[model samples]
Target: MILAIDTATKWTGLALYDGRTLLAETGWHSTNTHTVELAPSVDELLRRTGIQATDLAAVAVAIGPGSYTGLRIGLGFAKGLALANQTRLIGVPTLDIVAASQTYSEGQLVAIAEAGRSRVCAGLYQWRGKKGWQSQEPPIIDSWQNLLDSLDGPVIFAGEINPAAAKLIRAAGKSFQIANAMNSARRAGYLAEIGWQRLRRGWVDDPATLAPIYLRNPAETSA
Candidate 1:
């Protein structure tokens, strides 16, 4: 069984996957409450699912390109759990998890999420059956216009989309222009599935050194 955690944004998530099936899942907008709430949430989720911490054979965490503080809280707990339990550890890329949570679309498929400071983190993705999205490039942090200008084809943008981003895409006037949501927000259950697939391929990471995938320095922390 695998325990998965995702605190990549204000949306924090937790899930338990028993190899072939998802046993339990939960998520909420914690609004930066991760430090105080995550561990307790994990305990409650485990109790609801009738799972003991000792039952976890692996720990899967969404290492982020999103919220710095949230990522730290999540990964810190994941690493601690893995260390104490002696379970396998995996760090699924947060964007890949986001893309995996969505259905595929025609033309170029793009994944994006807010990157703070008015920047959007965008990445190119191709769906892999069972395994989910495989990113073609590292996510880039830029304005919506800059991201749109760099693209030259019909594209389906998934992940985070607000009215402002929708307006920016409409101004591009591409064939498949304007961002309207095609998928719900990302969930840790998808992260668990991807982590499981990676584990099958022998792709575990070292908990001692794993860090969040930060595409841009955090403005609040860096400043």
Candidate 2:
């Protein structure tokens, strides 16, 4: 069984997955209460699932491109639980989880998340039946205009965007689909499922070395 947690943004979620099936799931808009709500949420999820920490095979967490504090809260809690239960830890990128929501597509997939100020964190991906969806390059920290300029063809856009972004996307005249509200936010169950598949394939990382995927340096001004 895998216990997954996502606190990369204001929307926080938790899930219990047993490789092939999701046993339980829960989430709420955190509203800056990550530190206070994380543990209790985990406890409630495990309780509701009738499972204990010791029964978990591993713990998966979304490790950023999001609020610094939110990332820390998730990673810290995940690491603590992994250490206490002697279970493995898997770090899935916040953007990758969002991208996975559209992995079924044959065209380009773009996953964007609101970056504070005026920029957005975006990544481009392509789907292949043999390898599934893979990122084309490192995620970019850019303004909505820059993102539009960089696009080459039809793309599926997923993330939190304002009216301006929506207008720009429409003006570009490129075919695109907006992810539904339920999927606009990261989903822990999806993260856990993907993490488990990767882990089985020997794609594992040291919990101690895991870190958030901040596309831009802290000193850089948001675009």
Candidate 3:
């Protein structure tokens, strides 16, 4: 089975997927409590699903463009599990998880993760038929206003969008669409699915060298 974890922001999530079934999934808004909440939650999920740590064939984690502490904790936990279990370690880009949750649109899809100081880490994506949404560029740090101003055509925005950001998108005019809450929330199930694909293709990362992708210095960003 593949175990997926995402602690990319204030939101954190976990899931178990065996390629054929999504056995379990859970997520919550953490008030900077990921350190205390993540491991126990993982244990509970595994226990409730009657799955043991040894049963994991691969451990997948969202590698940053997120908060320093959050990314470190998640990756450290995942890496420890992989090393201990001798399983594959898979790292999925954080924004790709957000983009995967949305339905296909003819226009562009912008996946975003909150970056403190009124900025967001954003990635542009396009649907790739059976392959799902593929990122068009590397994620960047930009304020909502500047991000909106940089877009020229109809676009669907997803991930970590607050009401204030939604209001700004609305004010940007009719060409922009904010994803619904359900689609906007990043879930580890999608992360698991993506990880499963990579695992099948032998694209796993070396746990010893794998590292988080931070668009800016983590010391200055909150994710």
Who wins the TM-score comparison? 3
lDDT of 2 by residue, 36-79 (tens): 99998899889988999999989999887777778878999999
Task: Order candidates by lDDT, high to low.
Answer: 3, 2, 1
> What do the candidate models score in CA lDDT, each in turn?
0.80, 0.81, 0.92
Q: By summed lDDT, which 10 consecutive residues of candidate 3 come out lowest?
A: 214-223
Pick by lDDT: 2 or 3, better one: 3
Per-residue lDDT value at 18 in model 1:
83
Q: State in Å the error of residue 43, model 2.
A: 0.8
The estimated TM-scores of all candidates read 0.90, 0.90, 0.97
Comparing 1 and 3 on lDDT, the stronger one:
3
Better of 1 and 2 by lDDT: 2
Ranking by TM-score: 3, 1, 2
Q: CA shift at 214, candidate 1, in angstroms?
A: 1.1
Task: In model 2, state the lDDT of residue 104.
Answer: 76
Give the per-residue Cα lDDT of candidate 2 at 186. 71
- List clash counts for every candidate, in order: 0, 0, 1
Candidate 2: list runs displaced more than 4 Å: 162-164, 219-223
- Residues 1-223, candidate 1: write the lDDT tens digits: 8999988777788999987899998988786788989999999999998898888878999887777787888899999999998889999887887778666556667877667667777888876776556788888878888888888767877777778887777678785443344365777888888888888889999987898878766655310
Q: Top lDDT: which candidate number?
A: 3
